[model samples]
Target: MMYTVQSSGMLLKRFSANYVQNSTRLASFRQCERYGKFHDCRKRISHWLKAQGEQVAQACTKQCEFIIAQRIRRSLQIFHLYTRIWDEVALKEFMKSWRNRALRNSRHFLMSSIGITMYNWDRERITKDELNGYKKEIEGIYRLRDSTVVCAKCQLRIVIDVRQSGIKYCTCTDNKFNATSNQDSEGWKPYIEREDMLIWRREEPNCGGLFAYKVYGSFAEVTAEDFLQAQIDVDYRKEWDPTARELRIIDTDPASQSSADSHSDVIYWETIWPKLFANRDYVYQRDWVVDKERRLIIIISKVTDHPAAPSKPGTYRVTTYWSYMVIRPYTEFHQPGIEFGLTYFDDPGVNIPSAVTAWVAMTGLPNFLIRMREASRNYQNYKIAKQSLDASDTNYVPLKNEDIFEDKVLHGNMQNSERSEILNGKNVEDYNKIEHTEVPQFNEDLKEEEEEEDSTNSSEEGRGLLDYFYLAKLFA
Candidate 1:
């Protein structure tokens, strides 16, 4: 896809000029606040298999284990279409197919392990008419067919029904799968259209120059904070608290223009979702099963053992290190009352991290709730000032800097701007496209076993869509 717009736009910059810059830090977070969504924020998150996690996981395990064990027979028709979309997503996620130590050495072994692929013609052959509904109804379906590919160093691949077609420009992770040099012009335009390419905006008064940023090492620093002391703001809320054994949510963006925001959407555990996911099964996982019952959109994520990039001194510095994060559809929040709720993991704030403490401070709540009244009463005050401030004002006014607070302090969330607009439409046509599909209902059905191995097949090689969800840090 193409993002060639010169309509007098503001260029994005890193938090600092001296920080070491990488594509993720320099390009991803400069315009956008944080690199990843802080999904791990206050999650009842655990690497250990909790009973609840185990039960739901067990249900999914049944399905995936079946697939992994090669025990289930495949219907050529179903496999045909699934293979195409799988190939599409897999190709798009080529960066995620890197070979880890755990990945078998043989090419065929890895290919079988990686994913299933098919073609567009095969998919068109589907007939999802409940009346004529032969349409393949599987979980976790996305289409980026309308989107195009652009690669400077990355080689793109698409395996259709075991056949392979790759783009010379794009390469899978580890630069392993090589595609033909001939780029397909078919999907490029719409594909580009589907992306919310990191936009760079410096509005009135700030004048583009006042908000300039650059990366020196592994950092992105802001050279100036003209209007106010810029600070990071995180939107924290509970998804599912295993300790609490309940799901909670918060409006990370309280002032955001929406009611019933997740932060604001408080509810209790009414049901338990199926736990079909296993920790990265081996460093290079080529297979996963998505059951329509429990998982409609399966997010993948991880918590860095430590900060992604070290922090340094800069007027406005953005660390290059990994932070607790999540990536999902941009519209998830746009939904009337939708908020990110956890089904996989949770936190109880048993031992709040310094990061969470610092986050509270950055939010002008150094003492936390003690300053609640201040914000509660002054939210309107800030709103008035928010309207009056100009882009280049340089007023040095006490800026809300909400986005900054989220990125630097909160380790905010980065929505999945790269959604497959095309296929997502098809999903909508099928099942009303509900934001939160019904997950498994929580129950007392459990037969606890002493223990199981870590099972956390941490894969540093390929990043999963789940990366956007679990990697987010937790305050609890």
Candidate 2:
């Protein structure tokens, strides 16, 4: 039951800086990305029930619906844990108790044979062994116990459990509840959905920052390694993330070495913005870890100070933000592929209002994610082509499409689009029409019926892990 404390204070410093506030605890309830409202876990289930028809919903007992909601909540908490690690003493103690309770509960329920299997949002199965393995990992955190976990959902400090639950909400105790028969419970709702992307924002009372979640999936023939490599590749990132004007590693922790095990570095981020707004810059410590056995990769970038990088002009310096990315194999719908969950909150260091920023997130964020998927596939294809041929071969040369088109334009074989020129007996208009392909939009109506569940003062607060996963199940 003993925990290690950091002598260097680095981990302690990080925990202190990213600690969540009580008021923001209620923000943990999954909200509809469009309306900027909250939905109770029960309402989400009720909506599902009603969809099954009035007879089915009525036939479903309150307890059965509650159980479903609980399972979903547990599934989501497990996903949240994959995003980051929490090793604080209190969290360790909670996990220990929860682990003991789960083991005991399993035995009492005659789960001693083959154990049980739990399904996630993507319908991915998590076995009892896997859950126990996750718990074992938490137990191993005793070596670095000073590291506190910031709740991915509530933005608060939390001790997570694998089953029948522990901490799902923080001190700001709204939106925390296990679904009972009462369908009148209050909760958050989905605000917007575009394709596989879900965008939700809440005015965080904790830090006065606009908290947003951009959850999306990348369904290309890309491997988890490929996706993670692209995330850390600065040069490759610039091509995909159009907003990234400049990205460079500015510093690194002397204690952590550059190896495949993990890498810790301070990066400088300068992103482009519209002419109406100033550009933004961020200097933060980016730490990455790859769990090969679990097929999960987590990257967290937290705002920090570095003597090498200072505030610059025409670029607003982002003083605070906790941005993290979770990448894993998404096997529910497609040929086993990678999916990413990204959550970030920052006080833009500008005069922009939350409403305006929220509007921008709803409209532009999905396109940015789509561009990312396309870019990853493009890069992967380029790599495959180069590997299959000799670089010096004239006929098999792997030239970028832009390079080929640039040569044609220089030779006057083709004119810019404005000229309405012809190429190979085909007009520019005809080529444009043939090449255009529309991207699929997101399904925003998944939980629109639960919008009325928005009430911060609802008597029903979620107490079990099911609250998180039920919404996750619907969305996943």
**What TM-score would every model get versus the actual structure?**
0.17, 0.41
Model 2 Cα shift for residue 11 (angstroms): 99
Candidate 2, residues 57-106, lDDT tens digits: the string is 66677769899999999999997886556546668889999999887465
- How large is the C-alpha RMSD of every model relative to the true structure? 48.5, 42.5
Per-residue CA lDDT of model 1 for 1-476, tens digit only, reads: 01322111223323444545467654554444332344344243554345478688779979888886563345665788899999999976774566552353344454457732221222222121321121222221122221222232332322211221111223344544322222333211111110111101111132221111100000011111210011111111121111112222211222322321111111121111114322211010010111222211212222221111112232112111111111121122111111111111222112335455333223221111112212222333453566535544321223223342232321123233422222112222332233422211111111233111111211221132222222222222
The parts of candidate 1 lying over 4 Å away from their true place are 1-141, 145-259, 262-316, 319-456, 459-476
Error of 1 at 101 (Å): 52
Taken over the whole model, the C-alpha lDDT of each candidate is 0.24, 0.45
Global CA lDDT computed for model 1:
0.24
- How many angstroms is residue 418 displaced in model 1 relative to the true structure, after the best TM-score fit? 28
Ten contiguous residues with the weakest lDDT in model 1:
212-221
List candidate 2 stretches off by more than 4 Å. 1-188, 206-209, 214-220, 330-336, 382-476
